[model samples]
Target: TVFLTTHFMDEAQALADRLAIIADGMIVATGSADELIGAGSTNTRIRFRLPETSQLPDTFEARRDISAWELETDTPTRTLHELTEWALGTETELLDLEVTRRSLEDVYLQLTAEAAEP
Candidate 1:
């Protein structure tokens, strides 16, 4: 397994076979995107035909206090729950609700962030 430090999340995911994440010098998490997402990150991005688009804010403003926006999450189930709950509360109707898993990039960013700390 090769561990590379990268600011671009996509680069790390493309290069890695398996991901190992350590934060604060502790083993925070480890797994393939599939494994982690399968274990939970199953969320649906609901797009409603509101006759106009309300561009959702970035993670910083949206999920700052949630584990989903944290450096890493051990179990994505709780995080996924939080994401859906937040989404439902924000919008009126949820259409095109496609249940999704974590992207390789998201997973890689977490791993890289963890690997970067001194």
Candidate 2:
């Protein structure tokens, strides 16, 4: 048996086969990385950069910084497909496109925040 304690979520995720999140001396949640991340969320983050002159779809409320846009949605695959189709149709290149799932650190913060609520 091995026992480890650390405040770093990355370290915990790297070393532990099972994880337990404790807050205020109470074990608030326990699960593997995948389980914990999927426990309370289905949203995926999509980020991309487009030409400054290009227009985004009206349905997408992207938080824009310069030419980069970031948004979260549950249907990432479909969104990616739509973006691809749109790009092809408009003859625009999707620069720096990235898709990211919620990380262990995100899960930890969410669980801790919920545990703190009364």
Candidate 3:
């Protein structure tokens, strides 16, 4: 077993198989990167732009901005598949599609912030 301490989150995520966050001289959180990120209420977000005239399927719950729509779901694979199928069926185009997940840095910051809170 190897123990390493560093302020670089990317390095820790890359090299460590398991990680424990120490805050206030105490162990605040411990887990694999995926486990730590998933433990928080962090959902994968799918953001895209569709034609103003087009409407998304009812199965997908999305919020719309001026020209874009965003969907947050834990099941990104199935949600993406369903979205693509629906788009293909209706010949609608999804523009500027992006999928985002909670990163190790995000989880680390959240944990440290919580630890600092009174």
Best by TM-score: 2
TM-score per model over all chains: 0.41, 0.77, 0.62
**TM match of model 2 to true structure:** 0.77
Which of candidates 1 and 3 reaches a greater lDDT? 3
Q: C-alpha displacement of 96 in model 2, angstroms?
A: 0.8
RMSD per prediction, one decimal? 8.6, 2.5, 3.6
TM-score-wise, the better of 1 and 3 is 3
Q: What is the lDDT of every predicted structure here? A: 0.49, 0.85, 0.88
Q: Runs in model 2 with CA error above 4 Å?
A: 65-67, 116-118
Which stretch of 10 consecutive residues in model 3 shows the poorest summed lDDT?
A: 36-45
Return the lDDT, model 2, position 6. 95
- Residue 60: error of model 3 in Å? 2.5
Tens digit per residue, CA lDDT, model 2, 1-118: 6989999999999999999999878999998888887776655888999887888887776778865888777789998888889889999988899999878888888889988899
**By lDDT, is 1 or 2 better?**
2
- Ordering by TM-score: 2, 3, 1
Model 2 scores a C-alpha lDDT of: 0.85
